[model samples]
Target chain A: MSLLSRKIADAVSAHPQKGALTVDDDRYEICLELRSADPEIGVSFDGLDFRALDASPRSVETLKAWGERLASRLTYLMEPLVVLEVDRIGTEVELRSAKPSVRESQLRYYELRLESSGAAHLRRVLFDRDTRTRSTVPCTLGAEALERLVEDFTATAA
Target chain B: MRKIESDQNRFRQIVRGKIKSDLRKYITHGEMIGKTGGELVSIPLPQIQIPEFRYGQKNGGGVGQGPGDVGTPIGRSGEGDEPGAAGDAPGQHLLEVELTLDELAEILGEGLALPRIQPKGRANIIEEKDKYTGIRQTGPESLRHFKRTYKKALRRQIASNTYNRNDPIVIPIREDKLYRSWNPIPLPHSNAVVLYLMDVSGSMTDDQKEIVRIEAFWIDTWLRSQYDGVTTRYIIHDAVAREVDQHTFYHTRESGGTRISSAYQLANKIIDAEHPPIDWNIYVLHFSDGDNWGEDNRQCVSLLRDEILPKSNLFGYGQVESPYGSGEFFRELEEAFEDVPNLALSEIRNKDGIFDSIKEFLGRGR
Candidate 1:
């Protein structure tokens, strides 16, 4: 298998719920959805509410090829995945969770609020259950950061 | 009206964005060329979302409410009897958007950062044009202005106190007749002529021709947008050279020795006879597999240096890679004319290389 296919397979395996990746021949619809859980990131295919998990090996290979093709066309997949919902009051930023939380989470929702302090950009991972718990941390807004966060979240659940 | 105009402008911006992002892909592919109309080309963009409404299940108060059986067929019988497995994913859609040649050229220029061309010599040709910019008292019946004539007659009647409040009938006399008058204006038009020369020898494959075709389409689009009138001439050569139409230039295949100078000679002859350098912005573009005969490279260089390069605004030479060819002609051109201002040379190894090759050729925008 190619390195891209292996990466996708690893991503799916790390998730707590079953996950599937579907990509069409023309690469118009490329989506990765998690079944039986509220996914941290959900790609809508034609605005249809659907879940696909336990994809075949052929589907994984097709998704890898599609990803390569899209990259050649200079279209980055992570740009669409990183959707930020920002609300600001004065200088304080209130970042709301754009997507629902995964299953088996103690918190009802989690928001990654980012704000600038002097030269450093600080973030607060706000967990809302009954009472809100905020943890200030340093984070960078990039593909690698998002990937690491998702992996860390899944690892904690596991 | 303002809101609609804003919405239309927003949609146009989105389309331009899509085109700009995929400009390189379009340059490497030739499928869009076949979908081109007179002044517009249709491009298929993937993953463009369209707004729609989705309905949800209502409360349990409708018909067929009594669920007494399980594993029974609900509606039609052969609904799910297809051969393939049922796919739960939504199908992909390609949205076809039509853009004018001018818009496509603008996107290409912005994407490639190509400079605007400065035509050399007397690029503009002045032609006398008649424009109706004034109204006169008398002229031909075909040029008569009915509205102006009626207003003039009404004013004359009101000034002479011949108007009636009840009748309000004002007839136009000879003196009150108004006609549209035209002045001869000298309109300057910039015209361009492109000479496309390609080697269709045995070493050149259909894939190489496809790359050339895609590149030529973009070059044509850009040139046509820049000039008021653009003329394209195609020349195909193997061991000999002959002028042909666009279709024959791209589709013809010949197996013989390569003679690159023959094409340059014919192009020079055509330009000298028809398109003078002073009056037309001439562009000579040549595509080949860089497999000229061993003895003809010197002749080709001499011909280009003495005849073609001096008269043309830009001379672009693209060398398409071929397995059978020796690929020595490009080295000769580079060694001979390393500092020629009008000469642009590019090596296109594959379809993807076409994007960079086009930029190299038109980047200077000579």
Candidate 2:
């Protein structure tokens, strides 16, 4: 258990409903909101931000995994999130997903939103070129699934 | 007058033909929903020119009689040079023609080639029609038979030797009054009741609701043309189900989990209470994104197979595609009710699929 991982696990235990914790000398910020019965984690890295969706109460292991993975690849993970923020101007955001399987004549992308409280929201976007319409839907991705998505997205964006 | 009526009928046929040709576009775009007023809808048809004499503007100058010189520009220069401004020219506007629900239904049936529905059970509505059966000598002035009373008065005058050839004016007195008497004849009418159940959960978007609205409008129109009396009921559900008006059914949105069986249970209760199978032809049309709770999907299947399907003349389930909804319930229904005769299922991907979905439901003609 490193110092950073212990800090994250402590934050998770302290703010079961709604709270925020900043660590790594103000390099990262994590906000928790559990009013919808599902824990939503909003992560801010430096100035760029994205949401880590589908965090469960039993996510201490997931938090430790994130700590180790995020320590080295924080810049790599943010490339896609930054691109998503630029792409999602003047469009509706529904929900977040890591892997988006688009159909024919469809364009799939991601969107990021930075809240006033330093929390960030990441949403999956599916745009149909034929109809010129965009849609997003809530996708259930547990903490483990989100870790895998982060790994996959960073590798793909790289 | 007969010739004028025949011309009007011809004009109406042409209008119907124009509407039928554009029916698919109208169904997909849903432009007619906003123009609906009560039992009539105003359809905008282009290129149907009505022949009429165009009167010139009062006191308007002729082409060469304007104030400008022969080579000078007409009126003020740069008058219409503004960018993106409304043009002053007489544009060809869409001619809005009002058609009754019955007429629109006929057009839809003809356009889709939908078979006429055979109403089930007994005639539920017994309407009383006032039929003139006899004549009475004394009654109220509203029902007085003018010609008969005049003839009676003329006969009385001639019988009493008071009618003159030069000035033959027949006066109808109280004794000569004849009144029409009528009996209330009971007319048997086959009726139907349509139960519209919609999933208004968070997964169901405004676009999906609009698609459902367009489809429902067409369905309502078609069914109304089939039966003498058609009563419509709307049920909206997320986690819980409740009955609402037509406006609320298409507009309401609730952020909750989906339990499709709740809507089915409410529909069953409504059917069992008001519309008995023995007396009325019942139709259950449910629109959802097919995102039911894992356990509730089974409950929905069982409820449909046991209660709703058996009582309904036709059971139509339209699964509208949504990115959020898992759409597992549609597959469940397909696996469960694959061979069910009255059950009609359709997958509406978007607005373009409404035309085919309507055909799939009404084509059964149950």
Using TM-score as the measure, the top candidate is: 2
The alpha-carbon deviation from the true structure for residue B260 of candidate 1, after best TM-score superposition, in angstroms, is: 0.7
Question: Candidate 2 falls in which docking quality class?
Answer: incorrect
Q: Give lDDT for model 2.
A: 0.70
lDDT per residue as tens, model 1, B65-117: 55556667686778867788779898776888899999999999999999988
Maximum-DockQ candidate: 2
Candidate 2 displacement at residue B329 in angstroms:
1.3
TM-score of 2: 0.61
How accurate locally, in lDDT, is each candidate?
A: 0.67, 0.70
lDDT of 1 at B36: 93
Which RMSD values do the candidates have, in order? Answer: 28.2, 13.1
What fraction of the native alpha-carbon contacts across the interface, defined at 8 angstroms, is recovered by model 1? 0.00
